[model samples]
Target: MVNTPRLPLLFLDIDGPLIPFGATPQQLPHGYPAYRSRHARPAAEANPLVTRINPAHGPRLMALPCELVWATTWMSDANECVSPWLGLPELPVVDWPETSESSDEDDRSGLHWKTRGLVDRAAGRPFAWVDDEITEADRRWVAAHHSGPALLHRVDARLGLTDGDFDVLGEWLRQRLEAPSSKGVSPASP
Candidate 1:
């Protein structure tokens, strides 16, 4: 098998992968419910499945090797909602193509619109997309369209970035980084 290089970009989706959907009520150490209905995905929201990553899980995600980018359908709304929740000074802003009038709720194309932003932002560097909606078609599209070391990792909505997930990502990163570079594509220095 031809070994690929490490991914430099980590695309993080806010909703299902990062936050649990329709979370049940449970009390926290602070006595307030850590995640009550507050964490549930609203059916009518533009990106219903999108929500903030839990405060407790934020640091572990930040410790990963790649550059984490917010890749959600919420667009700038993700920036507004997640920044304060994660205690980040500011969220990285992403650009998208101009929307057409035909774009509607049924249209899944917008997710790809966000993905395109990710592709451009990476500037030919390798990337790993972590999101809830990625499918076989999306994976094929990413492989065909993106250049170098592309990976698509799906996350369980309830667990977010679990220890298992981190271990898997870490192992993948380590393996790729260990591979000898070919085709002049350098492995990620991260």
Candidate 2:
């Protein structure tokens, strides 16, 4: 019998990455496309923004060689609205910690609130986090604190996850997976 090593994690955000909020006229001259198809887990009263998500992202994300995790403020609701819209299955959701002095300190120091929580969730394993709010502070903090490889990729709120963004992500994740030292939990998706 053999035990394969766990795959790395991909921490995904909702607002900026999947459901873009602040698109300028040039970035999206046609405005965002709406998906008229039915959903498997439709919301009780679905938010209009759910239509903005491109269902194509589901397969693209699933194609990545890592476990997918919801790391957005939407929490479990991401699975309810974003997942079904993208034809994705319910994934593990990261539960944010309650407001605390450490969070306040992190803010004063310019670190993103999600940074620590994500590091904690990664638990010394290789991971990638995609969000609009990421800054150099978050990257520096992760580099200083996290022992394993990490990528703090920032997506444009106006353009959402572009092809270029996917390129960077795919290359980094693939390289990490190919590395002999990479370690994590059971793979969730491809």
Candidate 3:
């Protein structure tokens, strides 16, 4: 039996990518559209913002050739709150390290607080990060530190994940999947 290689990791963020905010009146004249999900539990109804997450994203994200990992401040709340609303099963959540006084330099340097942790979590496996905060500095840091191909695609927080954004992410993942794996670097390598 041929063993297929594991799919790449997709680090997903909740606030910007799923629940959009910070739109100008011009950008969203009536504010962001809200989507209701039949799958949502009664408890989730307490939080009106949960409805802002389009349930369609669950299927769309699932269609991508990657393993989705929740990388958000929401943490396990993503599994408890967001997943049910979006009809997604429990996904692995990234456990972040507490920030230190020294790490404040990373913030000043334009490196996102999540950048280094995401890279470490990926452990050299090809991965894509979807967030509103990704910057060129994060991109450079990931490129330098990660041995595998990485796409630090930034999502517009006001717009959330648009068709154009998905196009870029899908295309990049497709190309990466079709290409031959790098020598001596296993998908499981960390």
Q: Evaluated with lDDT, which candidate comes out highest?
A: 2
> lDDT per residue, candidate 1, 102-142, as tens digits?
34531554344455566667666766677766655455555
Model 3 TM-score (2 dp): 0.84
In candidate 1 the C-alpha lDDT for residue 162 amounts to 58
Weakest ten-residue segment in model 3 by summed lDDT: 181-190
The collision pairs in model 2 are none
Clashes in each model (backbone N, CA, C under 3 Å)?
A: 2, 0, 0
The worst-scoring run of ten residues by lDDT in candidate 2 lies at: 181-190
Which has the greatest TM-score? 2
Using all chains and alpha carbons, the TM-scores for the candidates as numbered come to 0.64, 0.86, 0.84
Runs with alpha carbons beyond 4 Å of true place in candidate 3: 22-46, 180-190
Ranked candidates, highest lDDT first = 2, 3, 1
TM-score between model 2 and native: 0.86
